[model samples]
Target chain A: MKVTVRYFAQLRDAAGTGSEQVEGDFRTPADLWTHLCARHVFPLGAADLRVSVNARYVPFEAPLGEGDEVAFIPPVSGG
Target chain B: MFVLQASPLPGGADLLPPGDLACGGVVVFEGRVRDHNEGRAVTALEYEAYEALAQAEGERILAEAAQRFGPVRVAAAHRQGLLQLGEAAVVVVAASAHRQEAFAACRWVIDAIKERLPVWKREHYVDGTRAWVACGCHHHGPEAP
Candidate 1:
């Protein structure tokens, strides 16, 4: 399966790119994220991060599939 | 207009969309960029967002506010990219049958937007330093195992 992973805020800065495409058979978003952290050391971790699948906020355990858009959301500061 | 916009958000007496005859009041809130924070002299702020997620979640929040505070129409817009100090970073407006509902709905929209929206603010200080603010889904530094 393939998924498009997007990063926002500081994570984007840490990763040096906002989005990327990856091929994996991860059962959950957490798995995909772990793969990313291995490739690019994101400054934040699971406890301070929120995962979203298909643009809706989801738990790290959320299922993943081909063509899914998975985003790692950092703490938002907008008021 | 639950939106993630690039320009300044609009306000004033015309804050709410017209047509509701029962609109007895409209409440508005604008969050501005401050000149300083934590003893750092701030110059400006740059906001970034996951547009797709932010838009979807922003709309959901407005819809929820309207549903929870019955008879109210809620709209909110958050800015992206660089924002000068004192500029409006976000604006929320609510119109309802009365002032109470209007105020309550407005408050609900802002709170939900802050916690749920996928927007991030970066503070540029006068000393040539910049840092991302800790907000939204998480706070604190790295945690223990």
Candidate 2:
């Protein structure tokens, strides 16, 4: 299933774009991350990042749906 | 109230809502961009956020603070984009009937924001190098083999 992926901070710098559409039969966020890592040299690993689907935080193992909006969140540093 | 904006944040006093007759104590916390970090002389900092989720999560944090320390009113705002040294990057204000709750709520809100907000800071050093500020609680650098 295809999904829209969003990147922020370091991931954004690595991805070279804020968001993009990826076409693949990705089963979960982890699967999608693996696919993305192959394309972009992200600074952090999947275990160090959090996954959000449709703007809500979810486990990396959570299932992905077609047209889902996914974001790989890096370590937050807001004050 | 929780807000993420590209414009400069309101002054600490301006961030507080109108006075509440029942509330006798008020506390405000402003996080400013410092000139140095990690032994490096920082020139400036840029903050980026997942606006949609950051707004939602930030509002949730304020709501949680209100519930946890009831009889208090809390509000917070975080600035986006570039910020110069000594500029207020974020602000939090809390008012309550007594000093303890107001102080506690204000502190709680800021701490929670640091941990949960979908915001990132990039520090630009005097030597022209830059790096994302990694939260000490997370393993953010190069991945382990």
Tell me the deviation in Å of residue A74 in model 1: 0.6
DockQ, in order, for the candidates?
0.58, 0.57
In candidate 2, which residue pairs clash? none
- Cα lDDT tens digits for candidate 1, B46-72: 998888998999989988887899888
For candidate 2, what is the lDDT? 0.87
Q: By summed lDDT, which 10 consecutive residues of candidate 1 chain B come out lowest? A: B136-145
lDDT of 1 at B75: 84
Candidate 2, which CAPRI tier?
Answer: medium
Per-residue error at B36 for model 1, in Å?
A: 1.1
- What do the candidate models score in CA lDDT, each in turn? 0.82, 0.87
